[model samples]
Target: MNKLKNKVMLRGALSMLLLAGLGFHSFAQKKNWQNLDLQKDSVFGIDTEKAYEELLKGKKSAPVLVGVLDGGVDINHEDLKRVIWVNKKEKAGNGKDDDKNGYIDDVNGWNFLGSAKGSVSHEALELTRILRRDKAKFENVTAAIVKPADSAAFNQYLKAKIDFEKQTDEAKNAVANIGGLKTVLDSMVKKMGKEKPELADFQNFKAESSIEDRLKRIMVSQLQNSTFEAFYSSQIVKGLEHYQDQLDYNLNPDFDPRPELVGDNYADSQQRNYGSNDVKGPDASHGTHVSGIIAADRTNTIGIQGVADNVMIMGVRAVPDGDERDKDVANSIRYAVANGAKVLNMSFGKGYSWDKKAVDEAVKYAVSKDVLLVQAAGNDNKNLDVEKSFPDRRYEDGGVASSYIVVGASGPNDDKTLKADFSNYGKTTVDVFAPGVQIYSTVPDNKYEAYNGTSMASPVVAGLAALIRSYYPKLTAVQVKEIILKSVVKVNHNVDIEMEEGIAPKSVPFADLCITGGIVNAYEALKLAATYK
Candidate 1:
């Protein structure tokens, strides 16, 4: 198979918009819907609150360290500052290697994406990186010019080139299609003088000019499908940014920032001793949100309660705005395991691996150290059985990582619409499903927002793992993984899943999507963990 490149970011903007549209009326008012019990709330959440109330009520638990390996985190945020892991041996502001772990002043954690000079915000995707290296050799070279030995390399180049062009053109087209949609929607909202303007607002209304009439028609058409607030947030506010990212960094072939910013011997996979201590870099929105999901301060009466209590979050900055390098990922894993993280929540993934051997070695180390790893399956709707998602549980050698758990996204609905439309599924690839759609969590600058992705789903499972490890300290990583998988609440009904926009809904048995044919039940998992001792 040709090397797979990340589609980059979560898929299904329109579907997310539609979901937002349906729930926008109560979106801001909703709090911790992902923690609600199915019997009590009708929302198929992780049952975290119930577990806390019934099972964990008078139980003293140890503080477990959960590593957040992602872009960056706002460690100083009021919700996260209290729970951030501090390196006891390392003194702050000494500017010297106190712990002597090859990182300086790593009070919280390390940043593999940064150098002593600064850190990187944007970089080329693996697709662009591969194309950049091979474009010079294969731009005009024909099949006949290629040696039989180089045939595989040449085929990979051709596929990468085609995908790069196709993605760029699609991004350009989307930008052109709805460039000024937010402005138009803002104008309509102002004109209507209401929070949620109905479709009938323009039925008897008059437009000031011919151009105004066209814009009004556009708004009306969108309103016919979704509410005004939902359409505004999902389609215009989010859609434009998605395509802009593609144009600026993700799909841009010429943009290379590693040379100036990171300054690492990227070609050498073992150059792990070069990054700085700035765990929170230029962007921390994604990482902060993920951290908050795992363990935000519970007693602070802040934004939202995390899935686990008595937890310390270690921030390891590795993933950038674009695709993460395999070297950084491997280093992040080793760093976390060495620094005493019992569980690691990896909410980032890509479609390609630059060096499989390097990443595989780090994963093996984590397994050997008995550190539990939870990862997001992917956002693409494609079945992982046929497709590829990087940093998976599968090792390059023979056996799979026992402690690694791959999570897919699930919604709050108890009916047929439980599966998140964009979640990548595989009976073999994905180990479990968790609450991911419209997942409310903490962001940067003491803020909170709901994000949609497997990124959100992975943390829910990781949080549960941390909770299990904290309460039942005797349980091993593999044991915790078994408890999580075995205690899931299996759904019996067949779900009519919408695979694509125009196609009919594909009715798949809930068991056919993931290995555990069910949603993760926090209450049940904790109950089962009690007997393990």
Candidate 2:
């Protein structure tokens, strides 16, 4: 591990120097994005020139299967049809479990969400569960109040208490702040004689405004300026409401909504008889986008081609619109492993994971079966070692299962700010970075949209993993992970970027974000994987 880390660091340093020689910025300069196709020709994405060279060599592997444990995938998508994984054990539509694998007719994959078509907020379920089961323990208690004796329950209650307090504080601050901003904006809009004033209105106001008015106008102007929609329906407002739910009524640790969905407890992984063949769950967009990125058909002149030529996407609707449940994730991993999936791509995460042990066990099961799992580090842009995120192979005891790799999001430029503003990263938590910003891929309903997140980054690595496993079947899961880590090109320079705090922006060395301080290059990764044997 030490040797691999050192080689990656040294190679990264050299790559940075080489890029610098070619005028890649210490902080990459902004490029005009108008009419730009990042997938076809971009400095941050696949080096098309190099990729084409590899294509000529005919070195790509046979079709490989990657289990996508997110929302349901659009299996019928034109670009994705050839690559969607089919469960041969169970017939497609006989209304029976043909393979008798406990799940009833899981021809594609199982949906953990009770209804075959609905959205579940990660915050809503997890927070609601925690608040209900544990709030009583912390009721009106002083700091010195001793927790009751059951070690596991007591510990869980204590954690819930702390999380609840923090969330409550955050919700209060946000509601107050947003409320104040809304007041000022409301007055300004009334003054301008329009509810949704455009830029021209602001300019007109600025021309006639007095000095005091100008100061107020400047403050409002700064608040209104952002690529996102206005403050009312913004991400921050949503985040605040989410926190409020967690604080007030959603933190009960024992709350289980799976009963509402399937009338069975999800914690019982062995109870898999529930759920149906309706693979495209409530929101198919996430799964469809991911599948398109991994194995969408190429040269057909339809939607974009995925990273790999021959790949099969197995849709497992375990993740919902919000955070995923640990039980569902654990079962999904086992199901994929048992179903012959060599690689699993997890693009969802949560701040709370009550049954982490269950997830750890499932990860071990996959590793034992020689399966490699690629997970999204998250999108909070935090140093995760200081915080907690879910779907990790590492146990809380500080040990990691061999087959898991966590990915962070990198941008199209070679600068520090080039890291996606929303990417969650940590030197200890994340394995590598990949092109994640404005990634165009397949969405539900046979559509294509450019979505950005660590979600996109994970699928790219998963594709690379599938390719490596397909060609180099002799390599162990651990060895495959090491090859990917060792082959990355690192950058070490101070670049402007956002931080988790949402305070004033600051600059930091790009290398500090993840264990592999480089982006995943498929061409380089395949070369390294071949050499590993």
User: Which candidate comes out best when scored by TM-score?
Assistant: 1
Clashes of 1: 0
Flag regions of model 1 displaced more than 4 Å: 1-29, 142-145, 180-234
Clashes of each: 0, 16
**Highest-lDDT candidate:** 1
Show the lowest summed lDDT stretch of 10 residues, model 2.
1-10
lDDT of 1 at 123: 74
Residue-level error in angstroms, candidate 1, position 369: 0.4
Angstrom error of the Cα, residue 194, model 1: value is: 11
Give a tens-digit lDDT track for model 1, residues 1-533: 01111232324433233323222212332468788888998788989999999999999999999999998889999899999999998999989888888888999999988787799887777878889888888888899889888798788788878878987887786676556445555676678787777889865457776545765665666666567676666656667876787789888878988887788888999887878889999988889989988898888887899999999999999888788888999999999999999999888777777787899999999999999999998877769998877987788787888899999888888777788877889998899999887778898899987777788888999999999999999999999999999999998888767755457889889899999999998999999999996
Q: Candidate 2, residue 203: CA error in Å?
A: 5.4
Query: Where is model 1 poorest over a 10-residue stretch in terms of lDDT?
Result: 1-10
